[model samples]
Target chain A: MNFSRVIYNKFLSSWMRISITVIILIPFAIGIALLLKSLPIIRSDSIFNLVGSGKWAPSEGKFGFRPYILSSVYVTLFSFLFAAPVSFLSAIYLTQFARGRLIKLVYPVIDILAGIPSVIYGVWGVLVIVPFISGFVAPVFNTSSSGFTILAGGIVLAVMCIPYMLNMLLEVLKTVPTGLKEATLSLGATNWETTKHVVLRNCFSGVVSSFGLGITKAFGETLAVMMVVGNTVHISFNPLQSGYPLPALIANNYGEMLSIPLYDSALMFAALLLMTIILVINLFFRFLMYRAVNQ
Target chain B: MRKRKNIEEKFFKSLSGLTTYSLIGILLFIIAVVFYKGFNALSFEMIFKPPEGGYYYGGEGGVLNAIAGSVYIAFGATLIAVFIGIPAALFINIYLNRMKKVQNLFRYLLDALWGIPSIVYGAFGFTLMLFMGLNASLLAGIITVSILITPIVVRTFDDVLCNIPKGLIEASFALGSTKTETAFKILIKQGFSGFITALLLSFGRGIGDAASVLFTAGYTDLIPRNLDEPAATLPLAIFFQLSSPIPVVRERAYAAATVLTIIILSISLVARYISGRNTFSNIK
Candidate 1:
């Protein structure tokens, strides 16, 4: 009986270890799986033409991704412009000025905002931001839009990203060793001066990592951005113009992929591209963060 | 110099305050817009009954199919994630506790997995299904969503497990407990609240996410009766309905979005309440 019990314990231990191995292998499995699915497009088309050309006529066997890639970049850039200041200032207020009750209240609000589904954001975008842009903002800027522009997508994404960026920024600020702040205060430096010199200096890497993560996030966002970004397969830098992002391209084409030869491969390649870009960005930022911590 | 410094301090303070309050204002406005548009079209039948004929064309019916499907898929996925996640997290924190390098590497990998977008998961899930000769069904969705949320569950649980005092484990060992025994009996008991919170958080995320299930979970107007049947989800319901050219269908989409939001908000509230209550206070 004792021997059986010992064997049973050993089995359980090994089972757990195996589970850990399986868990650890997931990311690699996903990467390989995506690569294999996208292999067809990669083989048929020149790599440079696939990504560098603006034409995306899959029916004719051309799958240029330049327009989609540029659209993703521009939308993410616009989101950064709109969200960075709001989140940064909010982080400063929460960490430096807000008291216990205020912080307590604000934390849950941010969590709620983060917890809201992306689709709902898309719906809200269609309902409010879309009309607001085409009717009010576009007229002011001397342009008429369908309200489904890169600018509308950016505004919606910026709202969705604010809570995430704010949460990270608040965490970075909170880790700024209280002793340093006290020292600066004793030296009679004003609050703004101390924040600019001490808090910002110490958490520069954290801030950078947060923004980098946010950019990767905006780049990969699909359904919400898809619903509002107009899904136009054009290469234009105008924020008010309709654009097609990579993830949006993957999503919008899935239904019709079966009707055309190589269409499935094309969408798979888009998914692969998005996955690779996000993974690379995540890895680079993690490395930067790891080095900063060690230094 | 003193007066100039005071002015600068006041200006920055007010600026920060302005930005912070504006964020709150935006959140409120979003909620207001969703609820307002939703309530106008929301009805008792919309909540209790499935769609009737011609439903997509402003037909009569509640999104009962989608509501039920979302719950079913999210529940199944959360169950799988919990089963996989709890053991892996416990193994990392308990069995491999002494290896700091190994632990950090595991944490870093989990974080990266957490950051990978759900759409990639959807595409990968689709590939896996094809490789396995499976079709888009409830099972595919559950599997895909489980993959998407397992990292979240493990990371959340790991955050709680990391805070377990070393002395507790040492005491358990001194009491002649094996590593497995200590893990299951002591650590699990102590971290029960965190585990529950993790479950709810991942469930909330699983139910709310549309991108990951867009391809894996094929849509249907009827509630799936088995693992092999296609299932509709609330997020996808909203996405499809909102895209329709009909005004009434768009209103139904708003109603669906409202329901999704309320469910997620309640889950967050419950998580906070559970975490705040701090069970096992007597354990210390």
Candidate 2:
């Protein structure tokens, strides 16, 4: 019986280890697959020419990712700036100031918001935000715009990110000890003061980590942003001007992979670039979270 | 100074409250818009029948093709994800319980995987399909979505398993239960509800996702009869129809969106309900 038990434990442990090995290999497999497929473009074009130039003329063999990269950064950053404050405040309200029943009600709403697909958000963006931007926001600035600008994309993205970021922030805020808040209150601190000085201070790392996560999410978003952001291949600094993002570039052109000589490689390269950026962001934030937890 | 502090507090409190209210308002508005437009365009024929001639040109037929495709792909992907993910999560939480470093490493990797955008997955899936000499088909879509959502399933289930009380495991082992017996008989039994919730959550994600399957699942007007055949999905259906110049097509897009939204929300509610009930039943 003892011998059989030993063998059983050994067999189970080995099987579980194999599962871990397979799970661990997945990211690397994806990375290598992307890298090998994109290798042709990487080999044919200088890295600088690929990333630095803004020309994306597929017919001419030029595959400059500058415009797409810049637009992605601009849209993501804008959305993060707009979303972070709103979600932070809302999370505070829900976790600290709201009653139990109100909080309960809000959770489902948040879940619904998060559950809504990117396509629906894109639809709403086209119907409402696009018109609002072109007709009202753009005209106010005396600029004739198509309304498919980084700003519109940013707005839709910000709305999408709110529930996501707010969910994380709520979790972080809840981790702040109740006793810590009570102590501040007992010391005659106003509720807001306690929140600001104690709750926020205590969970600062968590807040930052959540924002990092939100940024990663916003950066990777393709469909919704693709729909609203005018898919113009231009290096535009203006939020009102339309710009193409990296993921949009990949999503738009992968259908025509066979039309051009290096088109597939170019799109694959774009995927590689996006995957690399997201990987770095995730690692950096994961490190932050790990350190915060350990501390 | 005291007056200034009080005013600042009041100002921030009102701002937060306003933001929270607006957030809820936005959710309501989105639902209202989808339903208002969708219910008008939605009909029994739309839901029950496949698209007929000139569907994209505002002809007779519904998105039954896309709806059916989405269900098949999501179901297959979720099945594969659960098959791989549960074991991985169980391994991490149970077998490697004592090895914190290894556990954290696995977690970090999974987080990285979870953070990857679906579009990249689409591109990668496309590449994989090409290499394997496979055209865009239901099988390709299923594989891609499974890869995309496996991390989500694993991570969510890992969180569930991690929260399982340690005493239960200890008692199982103390009763001379072997690791295999303990894992299947004890941990699985303990986290069954959580496993269901995780499945539902990932299934919802798979069904709703448009980006990953964009290239891998070649859209079809008819429901695919086999794994090798192309499949249309609701999100892509909504996307294509919305982009059409015809107003009628755009309205149908909203109908599709409404259907997709309803399905996803129902899944979320079920998962939430299960998880809520789980907490009550869990031993403290």
Candidate 3:
């Protein structure tokens, strides 16, 4: 009885210590996020007015994040639109049709691609991708100097994101039980039918979550986009024009300003926005994962 | 009739085989392209000289300084991250197990932090450093990268710790070990391999990261004399040099890139080998 009591006391003390540690660490971790969110720039009286202003000059205390925000969204969306279908179809092919040595080979290649450094991707985009896009795809798209255009950036972004999406989708497809596939096949379903009805239907939530995660990743990407994004703060719907992203804007302008409160606050404000977007997407993914696992 | 069915089956199998092989062929093409373009600019002298003023040719540079900066900054950040992240993870695993709501909240925050783009962290570092009056120091870069990598380390360590069987804890307690003692002696000791993997993974990531370091660490030609000074790294060197119009600088950029790639690849290979060996030993 005494020994059991001692053990119980030890457990209780450990629990308390853990709680104290967590309480200390939680605020330290979230301080960055909170500072980003609560800074004065987002709440400034001229916030709405600044959105319409094309000027980003720090000398006069003018700060406009609209162009960078818009470009980030536009390029991210374009990249997603290109990457999603290709990756989804590739996942379909791998999960459904791949066999033996081929599956093994493809898996390692995808892993390596996922692990490749972003800077390397940036180098490749600048060296090989830009030249190729200029020489080949630019004329087809009717763009001059493909060095810094949305389409060129989007293509590079697509290549970077494909492995991530493919891996997630493949993991999701693996969860569909063998019995479901057999049952569909026995009911006179073709291979395609079995895949669509049995596999994809069962993993719809997983697929959606994967897509959400991929889009979020693409949104936060910096190095490759910075290399090819033309460094101009302009808003345009055209994929053939150069523009800036939030990350690029932050990287480009942060060091140049010495003591402009508005400029520093604006960068913090953008960081806050980026964090919020990431948080929302991750929450959605977690919710979907929970539901998928629970069901 | 059976022989005829066999022939038809063989034909379909061969057709499917061809399509599968073609898919792998496309992946290999991408790798080949990386090697082809990257190799064209490689030379021994370029890797040994400092950068000239011109695009490719003017710099009298080797990448020695940048490589040293990367290793210094990465190792410094990894040490700080491991110190903070491991404890935080341990605390989460031990205390939050019963508090599902709080645990979930912490988990969500961590996931968001992990998902945040490194550039945003770079921006955060830039703002913070400016506020602190440290203008583009290597210390600022290290802190930013440390913050960026913390979530990954915490999550990985937490996962590994949580996977440790409850029975071990119970047994340790039964033997009169204190909670802290058991945690330090048994649980962490057993999970050391996984913790090492997380450390190495974050180290590699920090070494390869360019975007966050770009604004916070700003490029400096000379080697850092102190933590307050600006520093160059392999990734930033590659970024600046590769974009230059100078042929020699571009070639040097390729050499730097090749070195960076090899460093990252070697770390990853070590991670793989360690994990593989662990699994093999476990099976025995």
Off by over 4 Å in 1: A1-8, A290-295, B279-284
Candidate 2 residue spans exceeding 4 A from truth: A2-15, B280-284
Quality of candidate 1's docking, in CAPRI categories? medium
DockQ values per model: 0.58, 0.61, 0.31
Model 3 C-alpha lDDT per residue in residues A30-63, reported as the tens digit of each score: 4565465436765674657665566776677677
Clashes of each: 1, 0, 15
**lDDT at position B233, candidate 2:** 97
Instruction: Please give the TM-score that candidate 3 achieves against the real structure.
Output: 0.85
Instruction: Compute the lDDT of residue B250 as modeled in candidate 3.
Output: 71
Query: Candidate 2 local accuracy as lDDT?
Result: 0.88
- For B1-284, candidate 2 gives per-residue lDDT tens digits of 98988998899889999999999899988888788879999989888989999988889999999999999999999998887888788888877878988888888889888889999999889988999999999999999999998899889888888888889988988988877788878888889887998899899999999999999999999989999999999999999998899999888998999999899888998988988887642110
Best by lDDT: 2
The candidate with the higher lDDT, 2 or 3, is: 2
Give the winner by TM-score. 1
Which portions of model 3 miss their true places by more than 4 Å?
A1-40, A43-46, A51-60, A259-261, B1-31, B40-57, B98-104, B130-135, B161-176, B279-284
Whole-model Cα lDDT per candidate?
A: 0.87, 0.88, 0.73
